[model samples]
Target: MPPSNRPIHARPQAMRNFRNEMRSATMSELTMPVAASPGRLDEAIAAFSRAIGPEHVHTDDATLAEFSDPYSPSSWDDYRPPVVLQPATVEEIQAIVRIANEYTVSLWTNSQGRNNAYGGSSPRMPGTVVVNLRRMNRVLEVNDELGYVVVEPGVSFNDLYAYVREHGHDVWIDVPDLGWGSVLGNTMDHGFGYTRYGDHAAAQCGMEVVLANGELLRTGLGALGAGDGWHVSKRGFGPSADGIFMQSNFGIVTKIGLWVMRRPDFYIYGFITVPQPDDIAALVEALRPLLLDGTIPNQPEVFNDFAALAEGAKKADVWPNPGRVPAEVLDGFRKKSGAGAWNLRFALYGREEIVDVNLAAVRSAIAHIPGSTVNGQKLRGDDREAIEALGQPGQVQAGVPSMSFLSVMDWVGAKKPGHVCLSSIAPLRGADVLKIRDIVRDACAEYGYDYGTGITLSPRHLTHISTLFYDAEDPVAVRSAYDFCREVIVKAREAGFAEYRAHIDFMDHVADQFDWNNHALLRFNETLKDALDPNGILAPGKSGIWPKRLRVK
Candidate 1:
């Protein structure tokens, strides 16, 4: 049999000491960029202050700690920046870039700094200055006819949703699990949502980027001055430079034009449950044809009983025993909660008749699964109160955003709970889903942790999201989670799979796995980095694309 799984309990005294050490370290020192001289760094700070006001240039420990990665597996000292500059406009960002280049100081850019799982506002390399675009919040254009919205980096999902609702627009904004993150930032990171416009990157049309050399460039039709089709036309002339900027250090995106969905007359929100653990294979197999036929309009999420449980209750409350919970215990909880071993949730949008037809198709497809059930309610698109009442899961699929999903972080019941996510893409096949699931679940079990994960199925592909939650205050637990994540990445890659995105700690590792022809892709990325940011000043280590100066020859 397997080794007995032991519980990793949080030690209060150790945690207190750790917090004290972090506080003292942050309070006493300011870490300057690796190669930046004191005099040049001071000059850059002064220039930044002058360009964006003294109040926006922050060097205090409190502010720095606030921007550090709360979920980082390593110490905050590994990722914390010495200074943070908040720019309010595109011109201000350009000025900051120029100042950074002149001073030989690297910059890490973030919008609202709420991407907690992937590193929040923390820079990939410590000692780099952070360029926060929170102050540049603005919704520049909302074209109802064209079904698109042009927004700055600072505009959050909540902000955009409120704007559309306040103005009584007939369009809806597709948001991720959390509503507080910047829309442009999330889109740039290739984040996904639940609706038909779930593919955030694909929905993007135009971009306004501030290059490393302090030059401003508008992509797509935005290249044309006063072009009416800037937000509508995705491809303008020849080369599409918008993709090069995403998840790269090539440029800091100041503005973006994203396509939104017009409100349908009605929408049908539904859930399907399968009793057996391995029944997910059959469920995916059944849904594949419907998804391929365009019968289901939105991405469907399949969650194990443990994942569904973690969303509402803490692990200690349900299964106090350490390591992975016994299968019988999980089955008991599932029975008590009237949930299945595998639960699938999805939504269909259109007119009443159209949704009805699709709903019937979905039911007929999944009917073959033994001991399976399907249920849901159809709501009017115009009924705001009804939609909001549907809660986070339902509201998100209907184009409303909520922070309720953040509760999963607290499932470990720690005062300072945190998690790192490992999301890998697989073909939309039942066997592929099962393969990825077994790999991740077995790894979690071996690491003395419960398998807390789910799969988000798109039409052609599926995203396997495995969240490793731990007590951020416990160094041992943090390190264990980090190691577990790295091991999972290696295992997935060996099985011919790779992550869509990764946390700051694993960015390099993940990028290294995409080594086709002796890392030809990374070589090309380096070439671009050297050309665009010759000084290697803008986000040096983002997505494992480092500048020539930083790379070991």
Candidate 2:
């Protein structure tokens, strides 16, 4: 039977039934892992069910659909897992891992499975059973004195924030634009938020991992059984193994200790805008000194007018053009909306007098940019009413959790809108910023797509987040978006830049670009993978580090 013609998101009762039928058919014909036969797969599933009750083992269409990537450039079928396991306890996870090893069935792991644009909960290798840890969601400890919290993989930003507030803790969580994702998961993936602790990986102090052999290991201070200062210290007596687990397939991270910001006595949310498109270079230049000099404590984000406009409006409603929207149209919209060609948002946290000094320094630094303007609001850290009134962007920068940024996905005006971000890191220089911008813009133009890009400024570098928005229901658009992303990545690489992270389809492509010393880094990673997971039962092809058996050679 042919697949339904209805939109992916517009699923009626009939469409749901069609999906159920498709899932049932696919399950019956499910492909087993390379090392496992049908009997072995069945045995593995049965073992997993026994380890963590059958109620927690999901094989139905409804549950599997939740794990599939919604914004995949290719069909989700290409990356879907055959089964999923939900384990609540570390012992259960260990049992599941042992069973997988025994059966030689590969396993993919996720926390809340909310890393949507980067493939969500989907596995890089098809047929790998997903071990989702959402059931392990727990705020194990919140130490107000030390300004840190220990959490399980399934503890999300919202969960942590609510826990802090409910307990009247004085610490704030650094949340990304969307707050539905797991805190430990985001940190493990090197994801960033918008506060002083925006560098999530750096903010992480400790980890508890379950290795492929079902060995429980703790990194940093946690390695000492006492657990004293585990959440506060980032280093142990020996080498720090925490960095290796990030963005790697070596182990499954079950728990993490993250540093949170203590509530500032005063907070100021600020916006800087420039009237010309090229003004972004100057804006970046002006802000660099402030960041380096510690005048700006948090990561500030600069959005092109298109990106700023996307947050609230749709492209079809504004331009209705076949190609890129005209500059005049964008300019007119900016004027009507009282926005600028480039908009920068930042935050200041300190004592009232110190924050005022920093605010003055920030204003003075950007004062030279022609037609530039700055404005903001000040609030006490305890003023919940004022913080709530500050809205999404302000609230996000202030270490508050919000899902409002999800609206940007709908800018393409598709019933099932989607986007894949192509991010590249460059030095915090105006010339470098402009170089990346031009490369990305040219690639979008060549592919006949609108340019949607933003630059996030860290202390020493800039993260260029270029989005390719498209209609997920349209296969042609999906392919085009993927093609555009690939081209942009190559262009950026040739221009002496590389992506900090990548979607599952592009992980190998991105990893291949790191060819220093005949790919010695990759070789080293493969060595680790082989030593840790001999049977290759863990996620293979993750970050392009295939196990010995799965290596192309």
Candidate 3:
């Protein structure tokens, strides 16, 4: 395959020079050593094709373009691999792992590869074979009686949702904003959903993993020779190793056990709109108790004006040109669209009477804030609208998944659009949300971009996801968005907040920030990577945990 650098577009020479200088000083390109010879790389691809099938091994130009992330900051060439391999079963994965180890060919695993914002299906470094598991799509078990379902890496949220509904089970699975991603992939990536089971990591119970050396193992109670409760039991009699696999490249996850919720009796969905920018403090103070006390037992979202614009109003509806909207214009859009300055969406579950009491408590909590209006509609489990609403974006917080969230991509330029998202953990205090908003608002302004923010209430903390949107066809827009987001990551860290996740292009930079006691966290993860994968054949640069043999310089 031919090589290429970042896609360039017309921009000021001064700006390009400045960017190059800054990148050279701060972030230098790292090397994932190329294969010793073209013959070896060709041999590995042919061997993988023999192991899987000629049809399963994808290396055509069209397939390579499809594998490239259209929305990432750099050129598609930067993340392009020579081939993509599809495995249908655990046995096939094991065989491929053995072959990869034999050839020392790096493998990057992606579930559904629909994680568009954080680098869709792209490898952290180029030349690694993409192990896409879309063919292993299966709902192994949906045990309503046990309230847990087992699925493969390719089982998307939509797949699981359809399976459970068709099987006539009264179960709901938590999903992220977009429901096209894999159930196993989302959980392993620590993605967020808004439900009692919203925290995907917490909802995971068991895992089946294929190690680097072609060995198979199970985590949690499955570690036992005999166990009837592998899905429900999180801890085995001895050491539970499930936590180590999530977000790490030590192994390829074949199957995962997810705990979906039983259908609730009543559902109340609504939003509290605050008209003031500073009102985020009051909103946080109000919602923290309801969450901690279990009054509202689901993931509640606090979205600013831009989230509403991107989701409901859309950029095409307001500003066709790129740049931050004026404060007054944003306020007008929110008021017209019924999305206020800070819209707090809350959902209450359980019995009808209990929901009412909790609703009253929530109402009283925010009753003191001025210019705040509450709007909501309650639905019964059997209500037609409730069932119809299952296909909507915000319903994921209600334990239902939908692909409607992808509509946000079109807000900027719809035609082959791309975005970068950075998620950071914030203190639960009302003041912290304000600090977060200010940091992002200013950072975006520096680049003449919109400041999109969402504050999600976890039981005890706030996970704030800030997004930067751009059009893939516009190279200048792409670089600006990527460069600006990198600056925001550094600024937020200086303010004592660190992002939980980032795009593939920026993973190494983010990983470098865990400098407490001289980057002990990364050091420990490297030790595990070396011990688990000495040949460095599995996702060598994933999440910045590099294997010793393939360590980037």
Candidate 4:
């Protein structure tokens, strides 16, 4: 169960071989650009080495291979970029951006390269400069009293959590399914949290970003001082500039400030299942009272069958299935997860006595709904004993499933053709989630392909919803998967829903969701790219936000 034993580092043989080959190729061509001038490439590399030191300027086959291709389930030739550069400081990052702009070289920025499921960490264009931010990892400050922390983009949830606990701080990390992912990357992508502090984007107070033109801009309270940019307050005078950089390649975030939670005395984690699919509507109606009344303090995620089973990995010994507590798993799930109220994952946070009251209220509400039962276990002293168990992977009883689709997306290779996934988002609501899932499921069935979905409900904000899709790995399957993904996205727009994050390869296709005439924000990105990165240097084909390249008539 120790960290060293986790199979996380064990990549597939093919993936490893491809990485090694790519690394060697990168080194041989270190001084040469696929298209840029040799002098410019050398100057750029030299400037970068000067800024961060040559020790970190990796051109070796080992490091280069790791950066060349992304962990997407598709062919390497689909989204491979040539080189990678690791910058250690804000100044170094700014300098690199400046060079990229001047030389018209495309640069792709990545946090921990843990933006799994969507290929968010991959460069959309070939021969692009991947700006790896892992070395910038640091938890600059943790204000115990204010309940806020400032960190660089490379700070992973695991890293931040350890720092907080080791420092004797009375706070707990709001870990998503995967604990190794970057904190800033998740927030910037609008990732959901499972606890009370789940709406991490809302928890973020401020940021220090290095724009494509090498200018540093601080938003919110950090904007008050020219150089003092690490303030952890959520708002300030004038417009909030933080929203502009997120989900866009317009700027590079060097450092970020996020608000954490102060330890409360008692908390509860449990699930509620409703058996019938049609009854979900009624269940949602029942949930409104509890949500509005503050009885269910944490986010309650409702999962369809396939997702629930896909959540856990194939294993040996297992915990005995607890007897049905209150009701049966929901109906459609019988074919998939096969237990009783299609299932609802939920939790409670705050005073112990208050938690009990809320639990009672939740039971009462569910009891009113036909055939819905609520059964859950409240954590106690020894219940969470494994949480502090250190050394190995599963030692800690984090209550979250260890196997995640995000971690194995790249590993689940194509036996025949190829497999790619698409993650689409919608404003949170029971009906919208159900509708989207049904539409996509029907589409997959029609194509004679098996499709699955995973749901993550935003803890604080009920308006943000995320669904991940999985299918076979053949060219036809891959194309069909994308076709199905595209069809749903287009349908989502017509149905009044928009995605919060998209795969780097599909950004251009997904951009159609936003109407050009009304999408002023995207328009601003185009105008800014023209001004800051005039040659279309910083991630030219990224985010599908940039203009199309000119061609001969």
* lDDT by candidate, in order shown: 0.83, 0.83, 0.78, 0.60
Best of the two (2, 3) by lDDT? 2
TM-score of each: 0.93, 0.93, 0.92, 0.79
Q: Model 3's lDDT to the true fold?
A: 0.78
Worst 10 contiguous positions by lDDT, candidate 3: 1-10
Tens-digit per-residue lDDT, 1-553, candidate 4: 1111111111122223444444534333322233245566676777767777888777675676566433333444435544578888888888888777666667788888767656645666555667889988999988787777888988988788778767877665576767777888888777756665676787777888887778898788787775444455567888887876776667898777777666656656566777665666566667766766667755566665544543443211121242111113323336455444356767766777877888888888888766677875555423335434321122212323233434333323224212345555654556766676666666665655434444554422233233333333333434445556667777667777666667664565566466556656556667766665566666654555553231001
Worst 10 residues of 1 by lDDT: 1-10
Model 2 reaches what TM-score against the true structure?
A: 0.93
> Can you give the lDDT of residue 198 in candidate 2?
93
Higher-lDDT candidate of 1 and 3: 1
Question: Could you give candidate 3's per-residue lDDT for residues 349-388 as a string of tens digits?
Answer: 8889988888888888889999898765677865635655
- In model 4, where do residues sit more than 4 Å from their true spots? 1-43, 59-62, 68-75, 226-232, 313-338, 380-422, 427-430, 458-476, 516-519, 547-553
Q: Each model's number of backbone clashes? A: 0, 0, 2, 28
**Model 3 misplaced regions, further than 4 Å:** 1-32, 35-37, 73-75, 312-317, 320-322, 390-394
